[model samples]
Target: MASTNAPIYDELFNVLFVIGTILFIGMTALVIYSLIQFRRKPGEEGDGLPIEDNLPLEIFWTAVPAVVILFVGLYSYDIYDRMGGMQILSNDMHSHHSISSQEKVWGGIGSSKQESNTSRDFPINVELTAMQFAFLFNYPKGEIISGELHVPVGQPITMRMESKDVIHAFWVPEFRLKQDVIPGQPTILNFTPTRTGRYPIICAELCGPYHGGMRSTVVVEEPEEYDAWFKKNSKQTEVEL
Candidate 1:
């Protein structure tokens, strides 16, 4: 599973787990206790009273459970707020963009949204195009972008992804993140890989015959090491292709 750096999410989850276990045990005990204490028989006297309407007990169960659920909800919301993120990027609010005199009309690059533009700070921009059977990552040169993606640990990397033929979902189980690559529409998914290890990146959708085999590995490494690997891979990509 994707690891989380947010301690509050972990703490809230632990509290929830504990409460759930308590609730489970309480429900089980209630069942067992009722089975034993209220077992009906002919000789039973004043024991088999029908509890069709116990207002106090009903209110107790309802209110207590509601309160517990409220606690969980409030705690979860607090955690989400703390873990959300920096506002340099958002659903709205972009920098004023414009086409350069040179590469004029590259669409959104120099579009009017360039004022508060979040795309500019994406350390290394990656264009991920998903086709029927594979995901091709493109990195433009003269700007230090490369085909083989290399990321520094704990830095947010945005993958500007889209599809050529059909919709495909990009997911990494270890990071617990997924986003769909839709045709004619670009999707931006930004995530920072905190762990230094190789993780599996798989297409979590059924696209075609090779859908199951459409998988890749994202290798996270130290900042310096990542730079070295990027340099090596850039050379290799040109020499090979």
Candidate 2:
């Protein structure tokens, strides 16, 4: 299984592919038919038929495309909203709110519509620092620092990311999540890992030399396993520090 929102992205992609295929085939067929049907025969003359436009035909062609566009626009917006796009936008707008405001605004992808309606458990907070050659994962709770990220399966996570030098992107294909990590600009990524396995974390942006070497892994395991690993790593990190 992929992340919770992966299926949503897949659904949208499938819809678009189908729509594009239909339009391509239909338009190609029409072009071929018009070319052959209107081609001059051996004795064909000029101005064979000065046909005027039919109101119903014109209306039909215009209405068909208008309806298709409307449907596509609405469906795309719905998918975006379901994937927490609106929530992210809202958080960004609220980030500029006055300091006196009590509520905190978080950016990047937040909870989906269904997740937002119900009560939610506290997400696992992880700080990600992206540099030229690597990504560092910092667990603030235990003061742990590691090159690879480790998390418990089926648990919500909120990753706060920033860049130490230049702009970078944190992208996990299975999770269908990508966010920019820019210098002096903090960003957030929220998701719930549904599968218990390891996924590669890649820097989708073109950083500097050896950008391909800037890669990591995220291990998602059961709660017990994650707890044990976290404890052991945190202790080791403390000793090294």
Local accuracy of candidate 2 as per-residue lDDT tens digits, 1-241: 3688788888988998999999999999999999999789988666767787799999999999999899989998888777776673344332322212443434556466324322433466688999998999987766679999998887777777889999999989989888888887777787888899999999999999988888999999997798778778774544211
Candidate 1 per-residue C-alpha lDDT over 1-241 given as tens digits, one digit per residue, 9 for 90 to 100: 3334234446777899999999999999999998997677777666555558989989998999899989988877665444442122332322212212232111121111112224334444566788887877765432343334556676655556778998898877776566688887666655566688888879998998989988877777887797666666564544211
Give the Å error, residue 220, model 1: 0.5
Cα lDDT over the full model 2: 0.78
Question: In candidate 2, residue 14 scores what lDDT?
Answer: 91
Candidate 1 is scored at a TM of: 0.66
Residue 50 lDDT in candidate 2: 75
Superposed Cα deviation of residue 86, candidate 1 (Å) = 10
